[model samples]
Target: MLGVAGVVVAGAAAIGHLGGSDSASPTVAPASAAPVDENGVPILSLPEPDPVEEPQDTAGKCRADRGDQKSGAGVIAAFNFAYYNQRNGEAARALATPTSTVQPGPELQRFIDAVPLGTNHCQKITALSDGVYLVDLSVMRPGQPVDRGTQTVTTAHLDGRWYVDAFT
Candidate 1:
């Protein structure tokens, strides 16, 4: 799992140097405001997730709920949907900060592009509070046609939402 996360993050970094594709942004609107209905009505309060089940606490909002053993599946799914849907331009604009940069070279870029194609999935999580975590995203590298990786992430509670600060 850790192996997979490493691959995904390093890969993204690599591709990033080719230039952050405007398409690499996320589709979802920032989760800062409120959970709105289709009609745009605001949702006040929602139930917190079961710590034993979800581990992530919903006392806050967005992807802020995170704890040990958490899969970060939400992050993975959301990121994929956003980028794959072509909503990545402005979404990535938010990451244009000093924290966003790639190292480990172009192998990192190929690693990212090769990630999803490898059938890697989030295996487990190690929570580091303040919306940060170590996510294990990988597939069985049992000599199968697959690649693996891990990512050390730092997420920030910004605008009442969890925004990825950095991944490496």
Candidate 2:
């Protein structure tokens, strides 16, 4: 009876030693997200986007080679250049009758705003009188062909300089 009790105790001790110790160490933990609030909700928030502003001519103003001339074609070219480039101030000064009472106002803004970003080249210039001219312009816009027909613009010589008066 004593020998059997001794054998049982040795078997239990061998089993406990086999299961207790381990050769493998624990793996390192991976990085995790930010901590949560007391209510178990995440605290992270996304940033807002910036607003878009209107286009501006940071590189001074748009200029043309023959914009200051006193001829009908020159006046038309200068006006068109200024209009397309959104240089309203230059257009008002360089393309209008020097002595006329008309000022650059909402009407000019409406007219220029209607034209998309592009150039208008003068195709023909006919002198209707000593002080008036009929200018035919070929309007061109980006991603579009040259306009199919000519737009006639009437310019007048006043205050000893050429000025755009009307268009048809």
Candidate 3:
């Protein structure tokens, strides 16, 4: 269940072959290209494929501070929906864990008033230990369309600081 080929040897021997097992069905090249020259051959201006570089996370510092699960889950995912959208129990008791039971009071203020607290941008990070982390909340609408549902937070160590012990 796999076939692939691209061995276009024109003057050494082989000629053409292409796919052979990968459920081949891809070739679609042709929109305006045909002309040869310059000690080479076929050339109509086909050169534009090299611009994909998005893989951050370079780990830069660590001398000894003891608390920064990405700055403590970016301060409890930036105040979880602004205190559950104004139900403001002093803004969810200032970022959860007053014996946290999140949605045990008023359906957590009607589930943070039915979706509408999006805009996370998700810079992606996932260190599960050594202080724990998993921030990815995907949902930035600066240009519209990104309202996924990928929230997560689980930091703890109350008293010395680390907050957010569960965001779901």
Per-candidate alpha-carbon RMSD to the true structure:
25.7, 22.5, 16.0
Q: How accurate locally is residue 29 in candidate 2, as Cα lDDT from 0 to 100?
A: 26
Ranking by TM-score, best first?
2, 1, 3
lDDT tens digits by residue: candidate 2, 30-68 = 236767899988777568768888754312232243454
Error of 1 at 98 (Å): 8.8
The superposed Cα distance between candidate 3 and the true structure at residue 95, in angstroms, equals 2.0
lDDT (Cα, 0-100) at 35 in candidate 3: 76
Deviation of model 3 at 126, angstroms: 4.7
lDDT of 3 at 27: 44
| TM-score, one value per model | 0.36, 0.44, 0.23
Model 3 lDDT tens row, 25-73? 4444454576768876787666899999985442332111122323564
lDDT against the true structure, per candidate, is 0.47, 0.58, 0.49
Candidate 1 vs. true structure, TM-score: 0.36
Best by TM-score: 2
lDDT of 3: 0.49
Q: After superposing candidate 2 on the true structure, give the runs of residues whose Cα lies further than 4 Å from its correct spot.
A: 1-65, 86-94, 98-104, 118-122
